[model samples]
Target: MVSSYPVQFDVDFPARPLDRLTTAFRIIVAIPIVFLLAALTNDTVQGDHHSTFTFASGAGLLFVPLLLMILFRQKYPRWWFDWNINLLRFSNRVTAY
Candidate 1:
């Protein structure tokens, strides 16, 4: 008796490993600094602690995901790459590639 079957193949794509620590460090450090500067400017203009706190809180909220991504980056490279690629792709403003 002979049996015939179609063969299935899986292709593995090459990917570069990103440094989670660096990504996290940038996100954690840079975002807040930028936000803080903006908030300081607002404070200088309006002279209100409430606005400064609001901006700081918002910045902290934004920072959380970046911190998490950095912490678990190795576990989700595809997600990370997709996110970064999409951002870069969109930022270029040219759809054609």
Candidate 2:
């Protein structure tokens, strides 16, 4: 029997041949995007002497809140779901690249 899932994902293959140079150097090309994703998500930088903490304002998903809500109230807010899904999509895209 067919089933309807709450969420689904798909990616289409490229019609044209993949660029050999880009394919070979994908890691180099993806460096910036990976860093961007890291900054968006939870990323920390440390120094030897003075420890400075940096966080992008309102950057990460509502993980703790969502977990608490699910555990205590058995609820998942729509807004939080949207935020998490979008962030996940960005992370996946960066990783796939």
Largest TM-score belongs to which candidate? Answer: 2
Cα distance off (Å), candidate 1, residue 6: 40
Clash-forming residue pairs, model 1: none
TM-score of 2: 0.49
Candidate 2, run of 10 with poorest lDDT: 54-63
Sequence-dependent TM-score of model 1: 0.26
Candidate 1 positional error at 74, Å? 4.9
Q: In model 1, which range of ten residues has the least summed lDDT?
A: 36-45
lDDT of 2 at 82: 89
* Global CA lDDT computed for model 2: 0.76
**Deviation from truth (RMSD, Å), model 2:** 6.3
lDDT values for all models:
0.52, 0.76
Query: Candidate 2 — which pairs collide?
Result: none
